[model samples]
Target chain A: MTPIALADYDVVYRRPDALTDVQTHYCPGCTHGLIHRLIGEVIDELGIRENTICVAPVGCAVFAYNYFNVDGCEAPHGRAPAMATGIKRVIPDRVVFTYQGDGDLAAIGTNEIIHAAGRGEDLTVIFVNNANYGMTGGQMAPTTLAGQVTTSSPYGRDVDLVGMPMRVAELISTIPGASYVVRRSVHNVANINKTKAAIKTAFQVQMAGLGLSMVEVLSSCPTNWHMSADGALKWIEDAMIPVYPLGDYRVADAVEPLTKRRRPDRSQNGSLATIPEE
Target chain B: MAKELWKGNEAIAEAALRAGVEAYFGYPITPQTELLEYMAREIPKYPGRVFLQAESELAAVNMVYGAACAGVRVLSSSSSPGISLMTEGLSYIAGTEVPAVLVDIMRGGPGLGNIMPSQGDYFQMTKALGHGDFHPIVLAPSTVQEAVDLTYGAFELAETYRTVVVILADGAIGQMMEPVVMPPARPVMTEQERADWALRGAKDRERRILTSLHLSAEGLERMNQGLQNKLARIQQKELRWQETMTDDADLLLVAFGTAGRVCTSVVSAARRAGLKVGLLRPISLWPFPEQRLVELAERVQQILVVEMNAGQMVLDVKAAVAGRAPVHFYGRMGGVVPLPDEISAQIDKLVSEPAGGTGFKTGSNNGYGQPKAMPAANGVRA
Candidate 1:
């Protein structure tokens, strides 16, 4: 028998309070909405909503300042890390992070991100990789997959012409300044859970003053991919995952033990878990 | 509070430190590297102060944008080319109304010209500093002590107006040494106050987003109009200049920065020759001391505009004179510092023919190398 009452069951999920009630402008099936929710959820769990500053990059997420209910400023395309560095260095106690997309982080901003990472700036970086430029009408991005077709790569991405897709996580992990670096996907429920855990670890890395930390989440852009929402999710699992494998490429030894157990108060049951000190 | 002999660059750096600057980020460029180096040496002395030699001018300015937006007193210094690289960031800072200080120890150039001194950046600093309809408070100091004072005052002005304040110094000033009585350090914005103005976590207040990008035409118009009003207020309240011997003079020498200092000697020499010559040194170049210049133009028989470049500020002087007094220009171009004797000669010539026409006149050794024939346009001479 079908239940007539919608409020018959306990509340299982809802939007994070850290996120504004205003609807975001993200296109349908764009995983940016999911990524924003995870970030908001993490900020809510840490109770750092009031003390958080998000540097919104210039891309599809350029208006991220409006999306998050935290103090933020827009950075010139690819300069979010530099701005975050300024904010954190000026006010060290405040939590600061940069939200950037594939084109924003890997293209024009390559020099800035690399230098920011090399300096071991105490900030978090949330990078979204969708293989193509979602903004400016699907141009070939630095992270565009080999043989992937886009407006700039009308004849499919030519490895010989444009080189292989940049493995940002792998490149960043090589830097000694990067204390924690991980790549995760949000294509499925299981992977989405891992991605949230990685995001939490990135924040913890900053909390411990363990230097720069980054989480690269493989996202799907159904509109830019010219595929249905379901097909784009399938492509992320089949094509994107194989190219950018999911793993923790660099977790400094000091960070290893910290990630083992969760903070008790940060439970998902709407109750404070026993936060035991390690 | 004791007097100490300091180079202009070093004086500016010490002044910024005393002004309670929380952070200093810059990239090394000629004539201004000492300023950066001084910060590197001194920042370690203060607890919680930050100093960084950025990877590039682009990065340095963006970092400044961040620090400024966060409601802290911050600064950066560079030469002509480096400041050019920073113009884009400066535009963003202006649009967002972020308070910050930028120092330019000018050398020659449209490109990587030279390490020698030149006032060629006058138009660049006063008129077209950055894109969009924004104007920064441009201060030009002649001596090391004045450099220290202007640099110290610039921080306060930036905070007061919530806008960028530029200390436009020449390479000569940056390299020269003079005694300066440094200002005592005053209290700066507290962390809480800074966070209140900055995007320092929206923990206690509604989220504040510092941005220059306004999509709505009406919204952008309001922001731009607000900036214009601020600039108008700054122009009215902050016009600074020094007049020496202009009371009964038939000739007035108008100059600023190092060139203005040189004109002091020229004025004295012209007076020794029994000519009533005076000097008007503008301490604030952007405000241009136009109102005072207009008043002085009525009394003086002729005005001699002297500089180290191909006549930039003279245009402003001419505009201020507005045909009441004929304005003649004598300048050395491309980093060549004009000699007092040559400036005196120009003063003598302009005074000798008080009713003469107005045009540019090149001094010997046009800040470049050897002198060339001048473009003889309407009494213009080399």
Candidate 2:
């Protein structure tokens, strides 16, 4: 048992101070936990844990208020954007954000999200797109892919009847108020790292006072999807990404320098690839 | 300044602004559109105050909810159909125990009824604005001046109780112009004052969480009990009503808002005609002045309830009377404002008809013949 060198092995994990020391209610193999950790890490990296306020939506992430160590409030159904806009307007210096799900954002809250983006509200939005309503037991969400089977759409979705699934990232990017709108997946190591970078950049967009920034992350609900954890992750790559493509839909010129500076020297203090807002 | 004529909606907006409203969110709806319009014009004049014309009433109410959680004096206004869309937001505001004020200049509706004035929201405001075990503190204003005063004080009441305050006026009060003496301006709530409960990014303090959802039944039940206790305390301390000539009276008139304003003339005319008739106009509709109704019931021979709705508040009046006196109601629905003469005639009909007023007798201004439509007149409101 020779003494290992300090840098001999890779570090498995370091908990973000922005997260509370409690068990999360998320299911096993769910990407919600991974995404939450990314947000926590971003908050820590930016030193904005004390100044960030989150508006949690009314889906599976309704209890997001409990996991985050930062200040938060709950918005009814698809109303996080409206709620976050309110907090930001009253206290413009504060960093305000909303954590929403597919059913909450793409379904009931389309109007609020669209209006908030259209208003060019200075806010960050982390939209978790998992095809169906996970909390309500796999109902057909507005983001449900065509030919996708769900509890409400047992015989696969009918494009003629219900129409194609909404491409939220692309749709929101079309709004003039949108400064940085991107879609990423959290199914694998490479995509997960990209998702984290996207989350950090979106927050930077808010801190930069550019415009409304949102990252629509393609996630999995293995329990609801009736698949094992690994299968669900694979499903996101195989099925979900085609219907909801991953990439930047809108990027303001002001945010390009921040993304261009991505992880140029990650060995330098931290793995987070964010430039501090001046 | 000396009393100046002000439109009801605009005056309420001005009063709310003077009450230190930092943010005002609302949708454009008839009867109350002028309130939102005035906010749009006036709020931006201030350096930091906010006025947003939300996409809909739902958005407006939620904006109010968000601002309230931030611990600012925020308000929104709408008429009936618009207010109906705000119930969910109002419920969340209530459950979160954050203060918010809403001015509902009611219009006729169970659904998009009309733009004319009506008291159809009697149940909606006092009993259930949304799905919850909570009642908002409701203040009814009968005149432009009263609307100004109530709208000004609504902020303080909401913040003091950490609950929702609804200023319940109607289209007649909103659309009509009358003399109003505006109150002196109050300083907007400083962020320092909101340090206790508001979520201003949790700088230099522990994180704050405001939400209405309680996952466990026990947790929700406790929250419900807490809300119930707050309401009960409000009921004990905040009963408000105006009594006109109830000392020596045989016939007592009960009403609120526009109908109550018209009842004043009815009382004066009856007194001039050598009748001892008094009026009890409830200013607070939720606490409802039930105790005073009981006291008045002890002295009066007959109690006549007048309202613009077909008979909503009369039910409450009857329950308060509790067989103490014969309770009779006369009302006009579908946006018809009841006239002083019509109310006076109904009082005569009630006294002449029977000795025992056990069951609630509902009479209409429309004679039994054919339910003919009356011209939508401004009537006493003008």
Candidate 3:
């Protein structure tokens, strides 16, 4: 009798083809899996799975090379931007990207990421900001918020001793080579959809031959943050967003047209439809 | 097409370009700054080539790691301090088994040592450049011409073994100007050639992931053993040394790089003075030419090891001789180069010594064993 109502349902969820069929090592409530899925979906949608290369950073995402179905290589801690720059410059046609964690990007790799952005390397960077060093246990990362308690900063983070937390997206946006720098989050379905869109736009910026593009996603770290999965998601909304606001920090003129064309109405068919006169 | 006068650093940079290097990532450091400059100037002339002045030596080495992983010839250069910054990257490159060139125009150092010519990196290059049990194929060049030839061939050897190869030069060699003929240009790997191993894309095959982190102890042990085997093969095939007058001489001098050049001049003068003096220069410091050293020790009465450092290579020479002959050492450290006369004077002193032969001896026992006297030749010390 219940079969009569089955016609009302529609297919709405499926795994991205660019992701391998394997279990992730990320802990429950961790957002790395979501971010990985978003990137895989972006690669699948853009039809770049076979022409894409990824440089996995050294932090928690060191084994990300195993998760992505595209060809990849491991970059030593904090050197993904420089590594991606080298790969992109050598083979400009390939769609190269780097996936990095907050500690890897804002701490040991600050110089590399900054230099790569300043050089306007044509690549996409997915920067996950969890505010703590997850790979080596809960250490005080460069992005650790002021007054936030971490294993290394057990006394609630002395601002006088160590500097305030870094705002990576805003800082990166100041570089002239960066064409698109946006800060997004992945918690609920709506926010997750927005994160996916931001990643796709970053990839589009690369495909369009624009300058460097990066998307900084405020992700949850339940294990390191000492919170349950739901609590961590709530913490990102209540605590993290106030310090690191979510918004597009830079959308250079070269990427504006692509962003406009990326809207759903124009992206449906194989060809991009010209906008009608207003 | 005549030979041109080029600085040691610039010549190495040009030779890398001609050897089909497609990417160059380097940081500016004393003695080797000209090399980075030359790359910046020349890379633009070649299409598809990349030249990036990295933020630091660490970044530069990692950039080479990335380019090398993509199956292209790439390299980086640095001075002593800068090369020290690259130690971690070098170890990672070794663990990943990626092919690339590292040029170290060594300066004096244990820490921020002066930018003068020094052979202080002999142990760093041969024994351990970074954490882990791995060996890089180290090439020592004594002349600008040899520098060009060695730099040109370094890329090939690196690719053949899928390991890092070092061109170990001193500050003086990097700064000196000498005539050198650049090797003929070779084409960079074609797209098809690179596709064989490069992480360019997974279009025709399964995805490839280049990594060095093997978490399991057994997995890492296997990787270590594989690296050991590769090193053993290189040692067997790439031992290079030059023997001058050692066939009929009673006294032999051991040196490398600029120190070796000075020793050659000393040998010429000693031969003119009716002294049976000869020279043996090691071109590959890591493989070390130990077999050849043993052969020469069997024939020579005494061996004198000279260098710009206090006494680095002497230990190696002593081990190879293994008490077969007495080994004496003379050196000038702290950026001071030992002049040919200074080395010749030491040679004269050793030749004039009594039957004990300068009291520096290592026989059949290992390096740490007790030293014994060299056998007297015709009851006199040869």
Candidate 4:
């Protein structure tokens, strides 16, 4: 029998089932969904769906737990890093990560993030940098550009008072324990692919037990940026990328396989058992 | 039988070890410093137990916070000023209902109060020590034996109520030495027992979160109400006190912790002097022995309250008595502990007076009624 030739094959390019069907709380043209998709694809590909633990930050993505199908915890404002530390320490075998925005990671939580990286904790962090605080209606952020205007800075950010925008990828790259640090963007198809690669690499570094890894994604917030979705994409490409160049800030040439080496089992060694009462 | 002569602080450490404590995180401070020192030496000797000498009181408490969030048995101990520094962490633990134990070996307070024995932290322990509407289960131990027994009790109550349990003692009790029969060893939890909610290496389960903050007003109110309900259950089941000869006494000595020990001697002396005196010793300071005091108030004409501070527990005693009988108070401040003879003298004065007349009573014909008793000769026998 001759095989029948079909002219068309049906396929849908919609949201993943792991993602909620409800409308997003994010502004139109915001790159949060694109980043979410990249993370979801990686989670699905790595077969870590059941064991992965995510700490949601207190920002635009505070309700991220509702959208992600994996286990998630909502942390206090600027405390996602510390919360992630707690989760990772107690469950060292679990693949734990924190998703944070510029305001949540760079300002109030700077100490927590710095300490976690310094300690070389085995965890991953996904930092979304939109140059402003989105959920609080576009206030100034630690990453807001020199001349950008926000609700708190009506005359635009003054370099003298607030200082220049921080380059977090570059900053974290200097940390000795940071196994992998990269900066990526989500403006277009080409950049989206690069961001996905960066996220995958960061997770792979964590799985390898190299230590702390982070991916900083430059995203767009069109409503807060006072632009249309297309305009916001254009603005991110034209204005944001120049100041925050995207690339791997620090990458290890080769990492030891995490599975090859077995961690000392404190339990098997009779370390965690109760001692006789004195 | 595990019998040993132990310092009050060391006995507490031994009790915690026997109770299957998983970790001990602490900073050194006077009086209670032995507790941490002993833990630092002993905990490491036990294969599974961890003992950390933290960078500061802040760090010690946070380390405890970390261990507690992981749903393990952890403890921290300090003196008065150190406990003040721990209030922030304690508040978080209480607000989040993390099960843990804190031992406060009380010293003088209000500022850099002396490191000698004083009950100045009575209010801080029984009342909310931190900034919020939260209360910890406060246990006051009068003797070294009680120190061991109550510490064990604190851990059990903490897990049962899912709240912070405080063993509130003074320098005298914390530093004093006595014989103790240690408790039997507790069995470690099986993997299945802790696998449900513990954060241990998240395997094939949802992430667990431990936090105290709730953004919404209604959410916070609900949390507060839930905590109150738990506390009510504790009150019904955990209220503890000791009564001696209150059945047919004209005078009752109400005290707690080290003060109760001193009051015992005073009661004996008052009895010998032909004054019917008994003692009401409170073990639990939070669910306080209020009902017991009220019941005693009906039989006794006067209740003499002794403490090592400036009238903190006296307020609770007054509230318990409710004016049915006079509540007389004798206290010393700045780490000066009143002796048994001084307390006995105070008892004599109260018993000789009319019913419903306190030392602090105003406009009394007796010159130096309250203020006169203040600078009494140090009545400790040479």
Candidate 5:
């Protein structure tokens, strides 16, 4: 094989140590690569590479740990939140987050995420809503559009049997402990920038010691949708985006103001010898 | 500190508290109710301890599941029927390899049998308690001290092996008061110890995931093999039991937990009557004291299996002996506790009779025949 110039590495834009050397199994022009790049950029920007831990769920993102240049653990289907809870409880100082697909996060891990949010566990969740279970051959996800067809829902998702698509960002906003919950898309350059901003905000909320924060990214699976990359972008804008509208559901401005208080250091105890004799 | 008077159930609760258990999730069940009650009353007195009264046994087990998933030392206690309800959660915990403690202060059971003491759940406990292939490290405490000691040991073992550990006792043991020396306090991991994996309010780091599902067949098989390897190592290193008066005795008595304590009395009484009888009390139900019994079976002419149920552990004893010695079973079930005097009387009857006399053969090769066709006068199986 011809050795490529180091300057060509900028095209992939991955960390030197990041383990995505092998080509991804994603279809041509799929946006999973873009989202992965954005998340990697956020980790690098925050300087949390050493102390950060990523939870990979059982989906297309199951190999998420491989792409992130940090420690990671894989969770069973839809159980990333629960597993993240375990990891966080033991390693409380480290930043923890779950990278999950729509099917894994919305369909199976609904209870785990809901309860974790309700309990105000300090963790970040990166929810990728592609409207289908992209990994296991295309199948309808909980976030699937009403008329979207997949392997499992050949006649398109029938609301009567499968129920209406879940609005995760809206649902999570109802949780009292959720300090930040936002839904952004990754179809176009503008939306991808917005999605990265939302992810960064979620991490900032956790860093501010606020509470549970989640960023739901409306993504595309072109091959699964049997559409070209450009067609998939239009499909998300015309179909997926309407059902799963993108916006910030909850963001606490009070957190920054509240954390600004100057507190006295009690560790020195006034040098102990300076204590006045009563 | 020397021994202090304590109830077995209270000791289990206190030991758990001292072991830095982060949470206690349980419902009230007779005999074992004291364990949960103690936790409720005492857990709050200590900082960092959480106690929750779940809606049902099912809820209690699931709550433990939730807390244990958080990598916290969580525990639950129940009797037979309650344990049956928690079996589903236990199977999940085992499947996920979540470390937690489950205390079963046993009572008589096939259904809601009785609230009194019984060892009937031996098979349900020692064998797989739920569907699918898995076993929890089962600790059977014969004394109040062991109950407390084993509760501490269970937590450590559970964490070490990444599996559930069951502290199996009976109503009599749970309720009975005895002198126990409390374990000294050990250093519990502070927030620093858990900073690597614990989800203490997420900081600016990466996310962590903990789970047990293997989607591929190859992944599942690898997980199962890993668990089996851990179990095999535990069986080799953690199996424990106690043998009393076995060297000179002609008859060996095999029992566990409360049944073993009862057998002690029977052995003492038989010895006073000049009948040579010994007792084998198993401390760990799983990785059972089979080899010890196999060794004892070689010397003893006959073995008497005593329990508070219809021959559950007897089958294990029989399996261990493998016809090396004639194994006889005598038990009481349905909340009917057999008195030590009655067990002694049965032992006396066996000792007084000559080999092959009284229609009961006394040889290693003797088959497990019908129970003499004797009348079930005492509500016990003949």
Candidate 6:
């Protein structure tokens, strides 16, 4: 019953030092917590946790600042990319990233993200696509899957009226300024491990002073999706992958060397993860 | 420093550099494009400086908000429509209590009025710059030298109050060339200095969070109360004004920016014509020179408020005068500039009238509006 009463017990795992001890307000089965952990781990691995600035967007992850033990700025809806650009430009020595969700990125902030990637701002973007506006109570998002049911799309999203969902990774990859653009999911352990690698690679590209690097993670929102925790994870693999198509949308010439091979002595967590060749 | 003929917009850009502006973010807008151009060309010359031409006013202002949150000296310049798009970011910056300098080189408009200089943004600048219970420190410069001077001092004021400082100039001041003795460059904010409130990183310290959002009522109200207290301190200590012939005067003319520039001549011509007239030009428009105006209102006969817009600042003048003196408004709408003679005629009417008459509202104000069309200018149509 007293699990940790024995101080002599071995500590198998610990929260990444980049993350604060505060409990997240994320709902059960919400993968924002998972994404935050992956980012924290990446920062902890890169040893840039102290020199990293996080830009928080207006969404479920608006308080991402509270969970991250780094300097942070809470940007307006859809404005995180611009804020990241601002931070990176002013403090180029510091690592900067933006944590944005579907409504914050695909819908309201399309302009800022597009231009940020277009200009090749030396910043990292962790965009979480959950197919709905999670914080705003499951409204139809720009990334809302076609024919998906939601509050705003009560009769399901009609492609004729609202148009097709935006594939942000593919769109951003077309910009010459974007050095690394990819989409990954957290539906299962394999994909979760891959998503963590992609997140780490993004920070690596930024650290290398390459260009705008974005890792769009397909996250699960069980509460908003009106599904059980297990069902939301399964839905990403069954329904989300077909539309999103997890793949490397863009890898600039300079980034290939870093991506193609795993550095010899990496993975302090003891999991040698690899990007899905697909 | 030797005086050199510098264009207003360019003077502002150089002044920003002298103030050691760390970043410049803006979109190209008429009468203020030179400022952005100058930055684009020169920001790179400095070892580590930033110059970004944002996609739109909305994007530009947000970039400004981002840079401001970093606790650096940043600048943005735009005319009316562009400034309108910036309202959202300005509000967030105000709530966040960050320092930023905005130079609003006013052209004309409630709409696409003209490229002609007009003080139409008086209400927009001094009153509702952005929504919320907040106010920006507004400095309206009357000439190019003054514009440079204000641009030099604005950053300090903004950082001092941790608020936005808007250097309000019009197209005339922005476009015209004037002799300016530029101030030497002040040292840029050091990293140690910025660590006080900037969001650079959490190195060797607790993380810093700069956010305006407070979901709970108590939290937001406390922030608002703090903002109000800061504004009160600004209003008390930062009221600036320039008065001439007010030592013994019957009629005092109230105006700012270009209106104030022209009224100086109007007052001189009126005085030459045997009238005891003075000009009370307000330099700091937000703190508003209200107390000074109220004090002067006690001695003056009828306070005449002159502007290039349709009676905006007169409202504040009236509120401050509070019937201590009767306030009459003389303004030219549709981006029309009120000539000295036109203002003098209005003053003549006010002086000749025995007691009470809405002296300048008799449709004759449109006289200036009729001839507003020029080859390069907009607004007047055939």
Per-prediction TM-score, please?
A: 0.92, 0.94, 0.93, 0.79, 0.75, 0.94
Q: Which stretches of candidate 1 lie over 4 Å from their true place?
A: A1-9, A262-278, B192-195, B353-382
| Best by the lDDT measure | 2
Off by over 4 Å in 6: A1-10, A263-267, A270-278, B362-382
Cα lDDT tens digits for candidate 1, B1-382: 6888999999999999989898999999989999999999999888888998788888899999998888889999999999888888898899888899999999998788999999999998888878999888999999999999999989889988988899999999999999899999876667655635677777656889899989899999998899899899989999999999999776788999999999888878766766677999999998789999989877876678888888899889877777777677888988999999887766655544423432445222212222212222233222
Output the better candidate (4/6) by DockQ: 6
Q: Tell me the TM-score of model 3.
A: 0.93
What lDDT score goes with residue A201 in model 1? 79
TM-score of chain B of each: 0.92, 0.93, 0.93, 0.92, 0.90, 0.93
Native contacts, share recovered per candidate? 0.78, 0.81, 0.81, 0.14, 0.13, 0.75
Q: Residue A213 deviation, candidate 4, in Å?
A: 2.9
The TM-score of the first chain in every model comes to 0.92, 0.93, 0.91, 0.86, 0.85, 0.93
Better model by TM-score, 1 or 5? Answer: 1
Q: Between 1 and 2, whose TM-score is larger?
A: 2
For every prediction, compared with the true complex, DockQ reads: 0.79, 0.81, 0.77, 0.18, 0.12, 0.76
- lDDT tens per residue, model 6, B36-113: 999999999987889999888888888888888777889989999899988888998999899999999988887877
Hey, what RMSD does candidate 1 come out at? Answer: 5.4
lDDT of each: 0.86, 0.88, 0.87, 0.78, 0.77, 0.87
Model 3, A78-137: lDDT tens per residue?
Answer: 989988887887888999999999999999899999999998989999999999999999
Model 5 residue A237 lDDT score: 92
Q: Over the full model, what C-alpha lDDT does candidate 3 score relative to the true structure?
A: 0.87
Clashes of 3: 5
Supply the TM-score for candidate 1.
Answer: 0.92
**Local accuracy of candidate 5 as per-residue lDDT tens digits, A111-193:** 77887788676899998888899988899888888878999999988999978988999999999888888899888877876
